[model samples]
Structures are given as structure tokens and as C-alpha cells.
Target chain A: MTRDIWKHLILVIGAIIVLAPFYMMLSYSFKSPGEIDRGTGGFFGRQEMMVDERCVQLRDPNRDEIAAAAPQYPGKSDREIRDAIMEEAAVACAMRPVVFNYTKAFIEAPLLRYLLNGVIVTVSIFVIQVLVALPAAYALAKLKFWGREAVFGLVLFCLLIPVHAIALPLYIILAKVGLTNTYAALVVPWTISVFGIFLMRQFFMTVPDDLIDAARMDGMTEFAIVWRVMLPTAVPALLAFAIFSIVAHWNDYFWPRIVVTGSRDLFTPPLGLREFKGDADGSFFGPMMATATIIVTPLIVAFLVAQRRFIEGITLTGMK
Target chain B: MAVIDAPVAARTSREVNRQARTAWGLTTPALALMFLILLVPVVVAGVLSFTNYSLGNSSFDWVGFKNYDRLLSRSTYEKMFIATFTYVVVVVPVSVALGLGAALLVNSLGRIGDVYKTIYFLPVMATLLAMAIVWEFMLHPTIGVINQTLELSCGTFLEAIRFFGNGCADGFPLWLGDRDYAIWVLCFIGVWQGFGFNMVLYLAGLTGVHRELYHAAEMDGVKSAWERFRLVTWPALGPTTVFVVTISCIRAFQVFDTVEAFWPQGGGPNKSTYVMMFAIFEKGVQQNLIGIGSAITMLFLVFVMFLTLIQRWLVERKVHY
Candidate 1:
């Protein structure tokens, strides 16, 4: 019992340190600027009404507007009319800090567009990887062919080349082709996933030859056998690869930072968040955290919902 | 009988030829892409390292061995090697140890250990850039939770420690800003983001350890937990240790996101956190010094491949038992 208690104590301490930044991120996302600055407001942050300073500035009434509001103010001075308009604008802009932060997170930059680009890039890369790697993995695993060992050898050698390490030359390639600042730049380099091919080949090796023989007896060609026979059996492995590929490409900052330079339309989520941080002042913490939370929430939530699968997918690399 | 068998054999050989054609057709795209994207870039980086190959240059003279020489002799490159190796050397062992420790602790607990496992793995799932930003805020010298909490312990008994006492007398060290603490802080974040992954791998390894061996060890009077660990657990975990260490070394060598997130302009205060990846990005991509960058890339590849080869050899030779 004493040992259990000590273990729990130590584990709980580790958990708190691990969880601190996440807690701070979510808390600040819900917090008013004042609360963030003062480092107060508990977990959900009082959710107190806060004015949008930018909105107030945008709605600041001019001389013509004060004159126009003069009728409503009756005998009030111009300054009083301006003050009344300002108060009304502040009131109109008043909202809970949480709402304000999230709205700003979506609106301040094209976060939705960045997210769309992320989805497009990840989905395209995964799909093309499956398309390219499946047939090759199937060939490598099942088919007896010339130079098969050489091809598999090349695959193993390519595994050592971390894509990030070769970013400069790849960037130069894309630049020479005038493809930088384009989706092609983001999606092209990752299309050939040797890891995916390797993983699928490993999975496919376990698939019995009898299955392919049965399909061939049914008049299936080699291509038909690869898709109709091997693909269904490869679903679990494919799902794991999908998760792995999606997470890596979605959170990838370096390659996109290199190729998608200066174009908002081409920015991935990380790049967009970095751009946000570049211009953000002190008061932008709430919105910045809100953006971070937004960017991080999808994967975290997906992992939470499918905890076992996520772990299995991520640790699949260790199985090598 | 000879005529009939010969025709059938010829037809079967035709089928085999068709099968070979299909196989080559299937692999052609991947092979082409592997050549263009993966294999070609290394060759390009090699050639570019020998020339003054800026992107926009119409023509450039060959620079011979000057780039490699500069990388060897330059102080900036020296700092880059030091920082990169320091991070790798410190982070690999520490994270591997922590991972093994966490795995053992978690594995000992039956069901409740799942909760700690989940919590620890959260960092591995979170985006490193976003988390780095949050950590930056948490390590903020004034309003950060760390310093504020330290201030709370100033007059308390917790200040009996020497570093804490001195900090309380003056102020807490600026964790990210201080030159001495910056690389260490980066290493801390690296370990934090990484160990959970190693722990998961170790846990998977732990499951593969046969239970009857433990019983046998117990029968042999491997009495204490430490003894059992030394006799049973450590040896069983040898392959996991090898893998976790190698992967951690590679990942540590590629430490860029957090460093870049914290110090966007320079590596760190006085270039203290100037790592290889950042140096590559700054000089090659940003400053258009492609030669030095490619040189670094080649060196980076050599170090990583060497570490992986060592791992392969160690796994094949020693850990096979």
C-alpha cells in the first residue's frame, strides 16, 4: 500500500508538469486580457464580459457621426455625443472573453483557410501515398519478379533519409520548377512515402499466398488482385498509416515554412500560428492561445477518442 | 507427350512474363519518385556543397573545399556542433532513462497506470510549435507560473535549498532568456516531448518479456525489486533501450521547432542554442548560403546514419541474447 501510494504520488507530480502548458493554453484561451496579464481567473477564466479594443477603435465615431447623433443627444455638446456613441459601440462590442478570443482566432487571420490547406495537404499526401505505395508494397511482398531485392533494398536505404534533412535541395528543386508557394510544393515531396511502403509490405508479408491464388483462380489480374485481394486485408494497417501520415504532415512546419514562403493561402496551421505570433502584441495572448488550442485540438481529440489506435499507429515505427 | 508439355510450358512462361511486366509497372512510379525526390536531393546537396550555388545566380564559380573548410574552422560552426551534440548526448541518455523508469513504474501498476500513460503521452501528440509557445509563456520570468510559484516559496521552508535561497534573494533565472539555461531548457522540452514515446516503446517491450522467466528468477532468489530489475528487466529491455536511444539521438539532432519558435531571429541569446538544423535554415534557406547548408546536411546525414548503423550492429550482435 505504501509503495502504491508513493508511485501514485510521483506519477501524479509528473502528470501535472506534463499537463501544465496544456492547462495554461486552454485557460488563457478562455481568459480576458486582464486575467492573462495578472495570471488569474482559474481554469475557465471568469468568462467576464470584455470589450474588443480593435472593434471599439473601428467603430469610433467621427465628427459627421457625432453631428448625426446630435439629434438624439438634443442639447448635448459634441464631446458628449462622441462619448455616448463610444459607449454604445463598447456596449455593442461587449462579449464574454471566450467568445471574443475564439471569434478573433477565426477572423483575425484566415485560420479556416489554413486549416483547409492542412486538410487538403494531408489528405492528398495520404491518398497519393496509398496509391503509389500499395501497388509497390504488394509487388514487393507477394510478386516474384526481377530486381525485387534491389527495389526493397532501395526502400530500406531511403528510410534513413529524413525528409527534413533534405529540405534545401527539395526547395531548390521546387523553386526551379516555379512551384514554391503552391500546394504542389507542400504535397509533392511527401507523396512518395517509403515508410508507408515499408509498413504495408511488412503487413502484406503476413497475408497468405492462398488468398492471392484464390483471387487469381477467379480471373483477377495482378492489378485486380492487388486492390481486390490485398487491399481489404490491409485496412487495419492502412488506418494506422493514415493516422501516422496525417499527424506528421498536418503538424509539419519546416517544409511548409521553406516552400510556402510569403503566401497566406499556402500556410499550414503551424505556419499560420507562427505568423500570428510574429505580429501579436501583449493583448494577443488570448487569441494566440485560442489559435494554438484550435490548431492542437483536432489531433488531441482524435487521439483521445481512439487512444489505442493512436498509440498503436505511433509505435508502429518501433515494430521495425 | 513432348509436344504437349512443351506448349503448356511455353504458355506458362508467357504468363510469368506478364506477371513480371505488371510488377515492374506497379513499382515504376514509386521508383521514379524515390529517385527524383529522395535519391536526387542527396546528390544535389553534394554537388551544391562544392559550388557557390545560390538560387537566383545565373552563373557561379566552383568553391572547391572552402565550404567544408569553413564548416571545420568557423567558430559559428563549432558552436553549432557543440550545441547539437550537447543536446543529443544529454537528451538521449536522460530521456531513455526516464522513459525506462516511467515504463517500469507504469508497468508495475496494473490498471491505474493507464491514466499516467495517457497524461505523459499528451505532449507527444500536441503540436510542438504550439506547446513551445505555451512553454515560453510558462517560463516567462515575471508573470510565468514558475517564477510566481517560486516567489511564494521565498519566505517558506522550501528556501532552505541553496539555489532556491539565492533565487529568492535575487530573482529566478530567466529560463529561456539566460544563456546558460537556454540550451538546457531546450533539452528539457526535448526530453518532455520525447520520453513518453520511449515509454510507450518500453511498455511494448515489457509486454514481450516472458512471465515464466520472472518466476524462474524468483526461484533463483532474485529477492529485491532492484535485483529482479537488474537480473530480468534490464536484460529483457536491451533492444528497447537500443532503439529508444537511437531514435532519441536522431530526434535530438533534428531539434528545430522549439528552438526556432523561441529564437526566431538568432539561435538564442548570444547564439547559445545555435543548433545544426537552425544553422542550416538560417544560412542556407534564409541567407542563401546553400554551400554551407549542404555541407551541414551531409554531416547531419553521416552522424544519423552512423548512429543507426551502430544500433543495427548492436542489436544484431549483443542484444540477440
Candidate 2:
């Protein structure tokens, strides 16, 4: 009993240290700038209505605007009317810090567009990788053909080359073909996932040959068998692979950083967050943390919802 | 009967031929892409390492071995190698040890371990760049939570310690800014981000260890947990340890997100954290020094491949038991 208590104590301390930053990130995202700097707001931070300084400045009433509001405040002096309009603007712009941070996160940058780009890139890459790798993996695992050993050997050799290590040469290739700053640059190099092919091949080997033979007996062509027979049975493997691929490409900053330069339209979530950080001064921490939270939430939510599957998928790479 | 048998034999052979052709058809796209995307870049990097090749230049001079020599001789490159190796050496062993410790501790608890496991693994699931930025905030010198918390410990019994005493008198050390602490800070973050992953792997490996072995060890009078670990648990986790160490080493070598996030303009306060990947990005893409960059790339590949090969060799020879 004593030993168990000691273990729990130590583990709890470790958990606090591990979770501190996440706590800080979430807390900061909900606090106003004043609260964040003073570090005074506890957890969800006094959700007091706060005015956006930038919003107030942008809505500073010009002479014409004040004159236009003269009828509303009849018999009031010009200065008094101007002050009333300014006060109204402040009231209209007033919102909770959480709302401010999240709204600013979306409005200050094209975060939605960046996220869309993230989805497009990761989805396209996964779809294409499945298309390219499934057929090849099926052939390598099940089909008997000449040069099969050599092709499998090539796949194994390609496994060693981490795409990040070879980014320069890849960038050069993309540049030569005038493909940089385009979607193709982001998606092309990753289209051939040697790891995916290798993993699926290992999996395909476990599948019963009788099933495939039965498909062939039903007059299914080899192509039809790959899609119709092998794919359905490879669901668990493919789900694991999907999680692996989606998480990697979604969080990937290096490749996109290398390829998509000067194109905000093509920025992924990480790049967008990075750009936000680059120009952010002290007061922008709320919005910046909000951006970070938004970018990180999707995967974390997915993992929390499906903890077992996510763990299995992430550790799939390590098992080899 | 002989004529019928001949035609049947021919038709079966034709079927075999058709199967072979279809296999080729199935594999062609992947094979072509593997060559183009994976193999060709390696060849390109190797060839370009020997030339003064920039991206847009029409032609380049063949500066044979000059790029490699510069990498060997340059002070900056020396620092690059030093920083990269320091990170890998410090991070891999520490993270692996911590991971093993955490795994053992968690595995002992029946069901309560799941909570700790989930908490630890949160860092692994979070986006690293986002997490790195969060770390940057936490490490802020004056206003950050870390220093603020440290400051709160002043004039207490905790300040009786020498380091804490000094920090109490003077301000706490700037975690990211001080030259002496930058690389170590990076190492700390690397370990923090990575050990959970290793922990999960070790936990999985622990599950695979036979339960009866512990009963047998008890019968053999192995009373201590350490003795039990040595006898049964350690040997059972051999393959997992090899895998954890290799993966940790590779990841440690590729420590860029935190470094880049901390010091985007340069490596760190005195290039103290200028890792190889950053050097590659800096010189190769940023500066257009393709030759040197390619040389560094080749060197980086050699280190990784050698490490993986060593891992493979160890797994084959030692862990098969």
C-alpha cells in the first residue's frame, strides 16, 4: 500500500510537469492581454467584457461620421456626440477575451484556409499513397513474378531515406520543374510512401491466399482483386495507416516550409501559426495561443476519442 | 489424348505469363515513383556534393571533394557536428532511461496506470511546433510561468540549496537565452516530447513478457524487483529497447522544430543549438550553398543509416533469446 502511494505521488508530480504547458496554452487563450501579462487570471480567466484596442482605433469616428450621428444625439455638442459614438463603438466591440482571441485567430490570418489546405494536402497524399502502394504491396506480397525480389529490395532501400534529409535535392527538383509554391510541390514527393508499401506488404502476407484464389475463381481480374478483395480485408491495416499518414502530413511543417514559400494561399496550419508568431508582439500571445490551440485540437480530440486506436496507430511504426 | 494434354499445358503456361504481366502492371507506378522521388534525389545529392551547383545556374564547376573538405575543416560545421551529437547523445540515453522507468512503474499498477499513461502520452499527440511555441512562452525569462514559479520559492527552505540560493539573490537563469543553457534546454524539451513515445513502446514490450517468468523468478528466490528485472523483464524487452533507442536517436538527430522555433534568425545565443538539420536548412535552402548542403546531407544520411544498421545487427544477434 505504501509503495503504491509512493508511485502515485511520483506519477502525479510528473503529470503536472508534463501538462503545465498545455494548461498554460489553454488558459492564456482564454485570458485578456492584461490578465496574461500579470498571470492573474485563474484557469478560464475573469470572463469580463474587454474592449479590443485595435477595434476601437479602427472605429475611431471621423468628422463626417460624428456629424452623421448628430441627429441621434440632438442638442448635444459636437465633442459630446463624438464621445458618445466612441463609447457606443467600444460597447459594440466589447466581448469576452475568449471570443476575442478565437475571433482574432480566424480574422488576423487565413487560418480556415490554412486548415483547408492542410486537409487537402493530407487527404490527397493519403489517397494517392493508398492508390500507389496498395497495388504494389499486393503484387509484392501475393503475386509471383520475375524481378519481384528486386522491387521489394528497392522498397526496403527507400525506407532509409527520411524525406526531410533529402529536402534540398527535392527542392531543387521541384524548382527545376517550376513546381514550387504549388500544391503539387507539397503533395508530390510524399506520394510514394515506401513505409506504407512495406507495412501493407507485411500485412498482406498474413491474409489467406484462399480468399484471393476464390476471387480469381470468380473471374475477377488481378486489378479487381487488389481493390475488391485485398482492400476490404486490409481495413484494420489501412485504418492504422490512415491515422499514421494523416497525423504525419497534417503536422508536417518542414516539407511545406521548404516547398510553399511566399504563398499564403497555400500555407498549412503550422506555417500559418509560425507566420503569426513571426510578426506577433507581446499583446498577441492570446491570439497566438488560440491559434496554437485550434491547430492542435483536431488531433488531440481525435486521440482522446479513440485512445486505443490512436496509440496502436502511432506505435505501429515502432513495432517494426 | 497427347494432343489434348499439350493444349492444356500451353493454356496453363499462358495463364502464368498473364499473371506475371499483371504483377508488373500493378507495380509499375510505385516502382517509377520510388525511383524518381526516393532514389533519384539521393543520386542528385551525391553528384551535386561534388559541384558548385546552385538552383538556377546553367552549369557548374566540378569542385571535387572541396565541399567535403570544408565540412571537415570549418569551425561552424564543427559546432554543427558538436551540437547535433550533443543533442542526440544526451537526449537518446536520458529519454530511453526515463521511458523505461516510467513504463516499469506504470506496468506495476493494475488499472490506475492508464491515467498516467494517457497524461504522459499527451505530449506525443500534440503538434510539436505548437508545443514548441508554448514552451517558448513558458521559458520566457521574467514574465514566464517557470521563472515566476521559481521566484515564488525565494526566502523559503527551498532556497537553502546553492543553485536556488543564487537564483534567489540574482534573477533565475533565462532558460532559452543564456548560452550555457540553450543546448541543454533544447535537450530537455526533446526528452520531454519524446520519452512518452518510448514509454508507450516499452509498455507494449512489457506486455509481451511472459507472466510465468515472474513466478519462476520468485521460486528461484529473486526477492528484489531489481533482480526480477534483470532476470526476466530486461531480457524480455531487448528488442523493444533496441527499437526505442534507435528511434529516439533518429528523432534526437532531427531536432529542428524546437531549435528553429526558439532561434529562427540563427541557431541560438552562440550557435549553441545549431543542429545538423537546421544547418542543412540554413546553408542549403536559405543560403543556396547547394554543394556544402549536399555534403552535410550525405553525412547526415550516413550517420542515420549506420545507426539503423547497428540496431538491426544488434536485434538479430543479441535479442533473439
Candidate 3:
């Protein structure tokens, strides 16, 4: 009985630690400045407090200093307001509230556009990667050609080179080709991935040779065999890579940062979030957390929906 | 007779060449694309490292190792090297340990393990940039919830602590802004994001360990758990450990998004947190020194390749499969 109680206690503690920031982000997002001062509403402050009208205008002053100065609202003196704001900030930082800041953030930020770009890029990358990788995977898995292992080995070798190392070179090429500030800049350079090709090849190896032999016996073209047989059989592995690739590219900030210049249309969610921080009052804890909460939700939802397949993908792909 | 014979020979040679050209056609696109995207840049970086090519001006004058010379002369560059090494050494082992422990604990559940897995993997999917934004708020010293919580907990525990007083004045560590603790904070966030992935890998590795080995150990009366692990499971997990460690080290070296998001200027608080890639990024994207950035990137690429080769050699004896 004591062991069981202890086990439950430990689990509860672990869960609290895991959920605390999220809870704080949520609670603070709803809270007014006053409640955040009390540090009680967590992210969502008191229900009675009204949304500051300035948040909806989209023409608010730079938010970093002003938002940090926010605890003075509702008849508080400037000195007291500053102190209160600081104290409230300290408390919010501790609690990690989710509400008031996020509400303000939603009204003020360009979250929707950023999210749209992320979805487009992620989906397009996955679709194209599948099309290219599937054919290459089939050829590597079933073809009895000279230099096959050598080519496969070379593909694996390229995996060691970190993407950052290639970033500068790719940037130069894109600049020369005049693709910067365009969607082509974002999509073209990364169309061929060494890691994806290597992964697909590994997955294709697990398919029985007889399956391909049978398809060939039917006089199907190589492409038809790849489409009809290998592609369908590799669904689970593909799904796994898909989840990894989608989440990775969707959340990616660095590559997009390099590829994109001044065009706001091309800004992905991560970049948009950065712009929000720079533009918004940094201390509007409620809206900031709220924005963060909004930003994080789709990914969390995707993970939950595809949890089983995603887990298999991560585990298996890491295998030699 | 000689001209007729030459025509016959040439026709046969052209037909033979056509078969060779078909083989080349099948292979060209993949190889050409790879070369264009991957190889060309590498070669350019190698060449450009010897020149001084600044952005805003595309003048590429051969400077003959001046960039390398300048870097070697700088104390800051030396510190960056040391700091990056320390980060890799500290983060890789610690993350792997935490990952192994978490995986073991999560795996004890017979079914419905997906619940725990999803919860653990949540941080992995959260945008590091967005998370950094939230964390910046959370780590705020004044009026931040973290400091408030610290005051509440520590004030209750220690007599010296007072609420909103001088000694406990915003108990939150400066995190990324503080020189002493910034690297640790970066490492902590890194471990949190990475542990789930490692745990999943470890779990997979654990499952692949043959059941017969454990049964045989039990039959031989090897009662001690540590001995069983040392004699059987540890040996069984060798390949997984190697794979995990190699990938983890490579990932650690390439860590840019979080550090850049958090610090913006290559590990803030006096550049104490700056790693190799962060420095490369600052030069390329921020400073627009394409040549220097390319040089730095090539240097890092060579370093990673060398380290990977060394790791492969080191683990070759231990890896069973």
C-alpha cells in the first residue's frame, strides 16, 4: 500500500512539473494585468478585467518597455505601477500564465499568416520528398546494378555534414540565382535531402525481394512497380518520416531565416513569433504566453493524433 | 580499302558509346543535384576560405589564410572553441543518461504507454523559437512567476529568505542573460527537447534485446540486477548507444535555433554561450560576412566529420550489429 502510494505521488509530481508551464501559459493568457500582479490567475487573470483597446489597433508602440510597465493600470501610481509590474512579472515568470498575454497577442500579431506559410511549406516539402524519395528508395532497394552500394554509401556519408555547414553555400547559390525573398528560395534548395533518401533506402531494404520479382514478372515497368508495390508497402515508414519531417520543417526557424529576406508573406510561424516579440511589449505576459500557446497547439495536436506511428518512426529511423 | 574500313569501325564505336550514354542518363539528375547543392558549396567554401569576400560587395580577393590567422590570434575565438567543446561534453552524456532513465521508467508500464510518451514528447514538437519566447518571460527576474515561486519555496525553507526583500530580490536566475548560468539553461532546454527522442530510441533498443539472454542469466542464478545489466543488457545495447551518441553529438554541434532565439547574438552574457555554429550563423546571416561564414562552416564540417570517424572507430569493437 505504501509503495503504491509513493508511486502515485511520484507520478503526480512528474505530471505537475510537465504540465506547469502550459498551465501557467493558459492561465496568464486570460488574466488582466491586475490578476497577474496578484500572481493568482496564473495565465488568465481576473474575468472582470477588460481587454486593453490598444491591443486591437495594430498600431501600438514598441511593446518591450511599455508592456513591462503594465502593472500600473487601474489607478496605481507610476512608481507603484513599475514596482507592481516588475513584481507581477516575476510572479508570472514563476507561474508561467497562459491567458491575458495570449489574448492581447492574438489580437495584435500576424499569427495566421505565419501559420499558413508553415502549413504550406511543411505539406509541400513532405509531398515532394515522398515523390522523389519513393522512386530513389525503390531503385536502391531492388536494382541489381553496378556501383549500387557505393551510391548508397555516399548518400549515407552526406548525412554526417550538418545542415548549418551547408547553409552559407546554399545561401550564396540562392542569392546568385536571385531566389531570395521568394517561395522558391525557401523550397528549391532543400528539395533533395540526404537524410530522407538514406532513411527511405533503409526502409526499402526491409521489403522482400520476391515482391519486386513478382511485380517484374508481371511485366510492369520499373516505375509502375515502385508506385504499385513498394510505395504502398512503405506507408508506415513513410508516415513516420512524414511526421518527423513535417514537425521539423514546420517548427524550423533557422533555415527559413536564411532563405527569407524582407518578404512578410514568406515568414513562417517561428519567424512570425520572433517578430511578435520584437514588436510587442515584451512584458505583456498574458498575451505573449497566449500567442505561444496558440503557436504550440497545432504541433501538440498533430503529435497526439499520430502518436503511435510517430513514435515508431522516430525509433526505427534512428536504427542503423 | 582504308577509308571504308575506318567508316565501319567508327559506326560500331558510335553504337557502343550510345549504350554507355544511356547509363549516364539514368544517373545524372540525382548526382548532378547532389553535386550542385552539396558538393559545389563545399568546394566553394574551401576556396573562399582563402579569400576575403564580404557582403554588400562581391569582391573576392585572395588573402591567403588571413581569416584563419585572425581567428587563431583572437582570445574570444579560443574561448568559443573551449565553450563549444564543454557544451558537447556536458550535454551529450547528461542527456543520454536522463533519456535512458526516462525510457526505462516509461517502459515499465505494460500498455497505454503512449499516454506518457505523448506527454514527454510534447516539448520536442513545440517550436524552440516560441518556447524561447515563453521561457524568456518565465525566467524574468522581476515579477516573473519563477522568482515568485522561488521566494515562496525558499523563504519557507530558509530563515535568511524574506518576501520581496533585498536578499531574495527576484530569486530567478538571469538564465540566458546571466553569464554564470546561461550555458546550463541552454543545455537544460536542449536536454528537455531531446530526451523524448532519445528515450524512444532507447526503448526501441531495449525491446530488441533478446529475451533468451535474460532467461539464461536467471537460470544461472545471476540474482543481482546490476550484474544482469552489465553481463547482458549493456552488451546488447552497445549498437544503440553508439548510434544515439553519434547522432546526439552531431545534433549538439549544430544547435543554432534555440541559442539564436534565446540569445540572438551567439550566446549572450559576454558571448560565453557561443558555440561554433552560432558563430558561423552570426557571421553569415547577421554580419553578412559570407566568406568568413563559409570558412567557419567548412571548418566545423571538417571537425564533425573527423569526430564522427573517430567515434565510429571507438565504437567499432563494441557494436555487435
Candidate 4:
């Protein structure tokens, strides 16, 4: 074995490319506005500047080193030095310092409230989806019925229409019902995902008929068989769909933007981040990144935990 | 026992039919929800396309194709069509090819396949709205790190030289701002974000391919790598390729967040990157032209359905069980 140096090298390169934007976001979140304005910084500096806790420290402590870094400015006084440092800190904090940005994100905007709203909407949608999808999938896969193929095919066909296509009509309906600016507007319309139904039906077909027959032999009803038997065995598929559903809704911006116009109180994390972009004519880069980090953190954590099942689910679909 | 089972057998058929009816009953709730949430919107959109519906308006004046006529007359609509079509053209092939390439590389490595998959899959998991904002700053004209790096690598002297400076005098591509380059940049970003997802699919498809096929090919004097791929690999991965192509095309057409964040003026800099989805979005949300927006959406729906049907017809005919 020659050790396949090229393979290892390619892997390393792939990893770097994948990590580049993240690394850049993390680093830029720490840099002062002045440093960003100048467009140059040491590759490895203090990472804490990206957070709000270390925002004030963004200013240079070493005047001599500062001069070396930027030879443009030299003289001045004690207070002047302090002001320059403060100014630099402000700018750096402006660019991003993770902690400061987060604090500002929470304080200047109703981010926490938005996050709570997101949680409610996301959870409610998921619960309703599983409830609706499970029984429907069981019937389609296990129970023989008239028009089964036609109905399932229709559901599959629905997947072709992009979400944007229905936004207008959905908005009108929601508006007519006086549901806009409320949680109902956000969650109710998304209760039944066609993709979820299709996915569950597909997975349900893989469940052995013998298992269902065995359950039925024990005097279990169809609903009981679905909830008690099929549901437990379909954990991997459910987890797979969970990742998809969570990511899709979590990152969704346009719908939320349209629906929750009157209530900043009910904004989701993405909407909250958009609002926190620039207020008072100055961009809150530090807080924005902090908010971005916080908003994205849960999704990243979810993926990390369920990665095995997620990959399996995706691959299974592909093979089909 | 055989004599006793005769009556039970007679009842079994009726029992099955009864079970089927109950099953259909259980399905009603989900079907209704789907109809209310998905189908109703589609039907309403179709009906609304023929009316002059807008926000804060009680009456819907029956316009009867006037909205469609008006939209078709607008230059922005034409530009949006071209931009969206171009985006689909560029994004589909590039993304599918890159995905397959990445999958092959990871599959060949064997042991660290999961690690490679995870790294690439991170972007797919990333929050797109937040990520788009991050990219905007990174692609900023003056202070962007990318521009600075290019300047550093090329050196200020080379940048100043007439040969290089003639086309790019501003020293860097105004990636988000320049109309001509914006769509291309958006396509690249879209591909970058999505390639990992399709890679995972291809990787799965590769694993399912029987190793004996390769052995047989090898026995047939297939020494060249391309020949092996053509004979042994391509046919096995047919489903995966069809899947990636169709899905990627559909997704590329729906791009909105990235372009919205990057080119905020609804694809400014001379109406360059104003894609169809964004046009529909702007119509409904920004302009509140509900009827017109509905019209555009119906058009998009018809277009996507037509494309999907054609693809299904092509792929389904060739699909192997």
C-alpha cells in the first residue's frame, strides 16, 4: 500500500474549503471595523473579540504594537490614546465580537422572544405533521384501499410545486381569516407537509406485513397498530424527516417576513437576525454574527447528534 | 378444524373489505389537511390569476388575462426569465457533476468516508438566511477579505498594469453588485451550498452497486478507468443521477434568500439577477399585487410541473427496479 497520499491530501483540501466561510465568519466577527475597513489582520489573534464579553478589549492595549500595525498615526495624549483604543474597540465590536453581538442582539432586538416563537411554531408543526403523516402512511402502505395509488401519486405530484408558488394565495387566505401576525399564521398552514407524507409512506412500505398481522392477531386495531407498533420501529425515518423539517422551517425567511409584519414580538430567529442587521444607520456586525451564531448553533448541534440516521435516510431515498 | 374454517374463510373477504374502508376513513384527515394546505392554495392561485386582487381591497375585478398580458410586457419579467433559466442551466450540471465527483473521492477513501461526508454536509445544515448575510460581507467590494487576498496575491503592481486593469479596474469583481456577474455568483454559491447533499445520495447509490459487476468488467479486459466507469459504474448510478438532476433544477429555480440578501434592490444594477421566485415574492409581499403575484406563481407552478412531468416520463421509462 502506497498510503494514497493524494486521497488524504484531497480530503484535507475538501475540509479546508468546507471550513473556510465558517472560519472567516468566526474571525471577522472578532475584527474591529477599522481592521475590516483596512482589510488586513493577523491570521491568529484573540478569538474572544467576536463575543460581547471581550468587545471592549478589541482596542489595542499595546500602543507601540498598534503603531507598528498601522504606522499612519503616531503622537497624541493619554485620553487621546484611550479614545483611539475605544474607537478601535467600537469598530471591532461593530464588525463582531460574539458575546457583545449576542447581548446587543438580545437587547436591541427581541431575539429571545423570536427564538421562543420559533420553538413553538417548529414544535407544533412537527407534532401535527407526525400525527397526520403516521396514520396516513400506515393506511397507504399496510391497509389496502380504493384510490390509494391515485391519492399517493397526487401527494407526490404536490411536491413539484415550489413553496413560493402558493405564498400569495396562502397569504390571502390567512389574511382573510385574520390570522396574520399570529402564531396560527406561522404554523397552521404548514401542518401537513406533502413531503412528510410521501417520506413516511415510503418508509412504512418497508415495514413487514407479518408484524402488522401479528399485532392484529393480538386484537389490536389499525390505529393501535400504527401508534404502538409501526411508530416505534420507524424511529430512524422519523429522525431523518425531523432534520429536514427543522432545517427547512428554521432557515425559512420570506414566509415569516410576510406573515409576522405587525408583531416584532413574534418574530422567529431568522427574522430577528434580519431586523438586527442595521439599526440607527450603523451596522451591528458584531451582534449580528453573535445572533447568527446563536441562531445557527441549535441546527448544527442537531445535525451532529443525528448525523448517522440522517445520512442513512438520505441515502435510502437516493437508492430508491 | 378444516370444516370449522369454512365459515371463517367466507367472512375473511368481507372483513378485508371493511378494513379497507376503515383505512380510507383514517386517511381522510391527512388528505383533507393536505388539500387545505397545498391543493386549495394552488386552486385559489389559479382562480385569482384572472382577477385584479390586491391588499386592502374587498372587490376582485375580473381582469381576465390582463395581469398576464401586463407582466409579459414588462422588461423585468423577460430579464427574470433569462436570469432564472441561466441559473438553472449553470447550477444543475455543475452541482450534479461536483456531487458525483466528491462522492467518488470519499467512497474510494473508505475509512474516513464519514468524516468527509460530515465536513461537506455542514453547509447543508447551515442556516441559509444567516449564511447569506455572512457571504454578503465576504463579497463586499472594498473591504472584503477575498478582494484583499486577490490584491495581495496579484500584487498592486500587476493590478495597476493595463492588461489586467482594463477589464477589472475596480480591482475586484463586484460579485453582488455587478448585474452581469451577480447571477453567476449566485449560481456558484447555490451549488456550493447544495453539492454535499447530492454527494451523500451518490455515495449511497455507489454502495448499492454490486462488486461482482466490477469483477466481470475487469475480466472483460476493461483496464482504462473511463471504460470501467462507463461500463460498470454509470448504469448502476442511473437513478441517483436522474434524482440529483431533477431536484437540483427545481431547487435552483426557487432561489430567493441569497439573491435577496446580496442584491437587495430586487435585483438592482440594471435588473440583472431578478429571478422568477423573487419576482413572485416581491409581487405578493412588497407590492401587494396579490392577483398579479398569483398569476406569476401559477405560471411558475405550470412550468415546474411541466418540467417534472417531462423528466418523470424520461426517467421512469428507463428506471430499473
- Ten residues in a row with the worst lDDT in model 1 chain B? B312-321
Each prediction's DockQ against the real complex: 0.82, 0.83, 0.35, 0.50
For residues B214-259, could you state the per-residue lDDT of candidate 1 as single tens digits? 9999999889999998889889888888888888888899899999
Misplaced by over 4 Å in model 2 are A74-77, B1-5, B318-321
| lDDT for each candidate structure | 0.92, 0.92, 0.72, 0.78
Q: Model 2 misses residue B246 by how many Å?
A: 0.9
Error of 1 at A262 (Å): 1.3
Comparing 1 with 4 on DockQ, the higher-scoring candidate is 1
lDDT of 2 at A55: 95
lDDT for model 4 comes to 0.78
TM-score of each: 0.98, 0.98, 0.85, 0.87
Query: What are the per-residue Cα lDDT tens digits for candidate 3 across B1-321?
Result: 997899899987785565335334434455566677777888878887788776557477988888787667787778678768878888899878877766666666546455666777777778878777666666677666777676675554563545445436545566677898888877877777777778788888889888899999999998997888888877888788887887788888878777777777556788888888788778876788776777788779988898788666767666564
Q: lDDT tens digits, residues A1-320, model 2?
A: 99999999999998998999899999999999999898897999999999998999898888998888889998999999988878988999999999999999999999999999999999999999999999999999999988999999888788888888899899999999999999999999999999999999999999999999999999999999999999999999999989989998998888888888897999999999999999999999999999999999999999999988988888898757
**Docking quality level of the chain pair in candidate 4:** medium
Worst 10 residues of 3 chain A by lDDT: A53-62
Candidate 2 vs candidate 4: which has greater lDDT? 2
The lDDT leader among the candidates is 2
Interface RMSD of each: 0.8, 0.8, 2.9, 2.0
**Candidate order by decreasing lDDT:** 2, 1, 4, 3
Tens digit per residue, CA lDDT, model 1, A1-320:
99999999988999988998999999999999899888888899899898998999998988888888789988899998888888999999999999999999999999999999999999999999999999999999988888999999999899898889999889988999999999999999999999999999999999999989998999999999888889999999999889888988888888888888887988899999999999999899999999999999999999999999999988888977
The C-alpha stretches of model 1 lying farther than 4 A from their native spots are B318-321
Task: Estimate the overall C-alpha local distance difference test score of candidate 3.
Answer: 0.72
